[model samples]
Target: MLAGQRQSAILEMIAGSGSVRVATLVEEFGVSDMTVRRDLETLARRGLIAKVHGGATLVDGGSTEEPGFVTKSGRQAAEKEAIARHAATMVAPGSAIALSAGTTTWTLARHLVGVPGLTVVTNSIPVSDVFHQFGRPDQTVVVVGGVRTPSNALVGPVAVAALQTLNVDMLVLGVHGMSPRVGFTTPNLLEAETDLALVRAARRLVVVADHTKWGLIGISTIARLEDAGTLIVDSGLSREAREELSEHIDNLVVVEPSASGN
Candidate 1:
């Protein structure tokens, strides 16, 4: 294939699969690995895709406009880790916590592995797996039963019913987007409803999202910003954006990347 043709094909593959590894692209296009890397680098420079350690993902895939696990996971890695670390500090030992399903929430789950005597209730397969992978005997995980969404979140009547029965001390929510007018929103309608249930089931709501999520609006609104007890975001957030968000949210906890160590 010609250089242009190869690049076009690679773009199509990323659009279809949300992400593409360099090795896979090289094999498919019968090109050298360097050629594939160059294509990805060009795309990343154009803001068409995000280049990660082993792959490239469509830029739109990270937004709620596209719901792909691999695509979302590869974007905002450092920001998510910072948010998760800050979120983990809010969870006390032996506390009953409700965790929503999202890339940021998954990061929090990984950090929660060492917390003892904690009861985690979640509707995310990966969230449950994180606990199961490294949870202590005193730490119990409750998987809320439901139909899984495209973003790997459990939703529907089953999930809502399960959440209704349990009362959690805090809910760590992950949203697709957040805007002053639209508040917290998600692309999936059912998942939005399920998230509302999660909000109702917990005494306090702590939303964990990176600065990228600000100003973006999704299809469905889960809750108003003021409803949340805390909003955890990265240091990259601008002063103007922070001021705007503070007006809507009650207790905004901006977690800077450097503060993660503390």
Candidate 2:
């Protein structure tokens, strides 16, 4: 298998358990000890794993720590729903759109199911599943090809290749974190690469993120702050943050969770 695919498999194993020994990886992949160590070293550099004396362990509570979809789906329920609700209104009927992998984007997919004659491209398994269960007959859903992350996002070189062949009217993205310096970021390096491809495949970009995403930094950046054509955030964001974001994003929208009705 290719290096990227091998690395993705290694991350999956680490995610399933907690750590992987160099000897175990060598045996599992039929590769040399040096190759396995190189994989671990690459992952460690990205902050995705912690290197021990003879093995690698998962990273938690830092820039590279990525929570599973189930663990994150329940967080900031109201805020995410509010952002999704408002973001749904930005879509026009029959428009081709790309939805990045995230809980908020899955929620937005639910909202888009009824829109007539629309086409949706996504790398998120859960987001595509939403449409599979509820999409109208006139709608089309394209599932990008790649390795699955803990968040159920399909990302890697395969996903990037798929995205390069398609163009969409808009890209509705959800990020792990955002800041002035690093802009939009993700904990997974492969995910970041795939997201950047999605950004390039679209004409307009709309970012949907809750207030808590502010100030946190991830291992890799997907885009700069000014890259987003529109950014929809919840009112829980501080007044100072709103001002700071508005300076970069021309269309910065803040919705009150209570007032934003589904």
lDDT of each: 0.84, 0.89
Best by TM-score: 2
Write the residue-wise lDDT of candidate 2 on 83-150 in tens digits.
89899998999999999999999988988999999999999999999999999999999999999999
User: Model 1: clashing residue pairs?
Assistant: none
What TM-score number comes out for model 2?
A: 0.76
- lDDT tens string, model 1, 107-148? 999999999899999999889999998888899999988998
Clashes in model 2: which pairs? none
lDDT of 1 at 176: 83
Clashes of each: 0, 0
Minimal lDDT window, size 10, model 2: 51-60
Compute the lDDT of residue 116 as modeled in candidate 1.
87
Give me the displacement of residue 1 in model 2, in angstroms.
60
Cα RMSD of predicted structure 1: 8.3
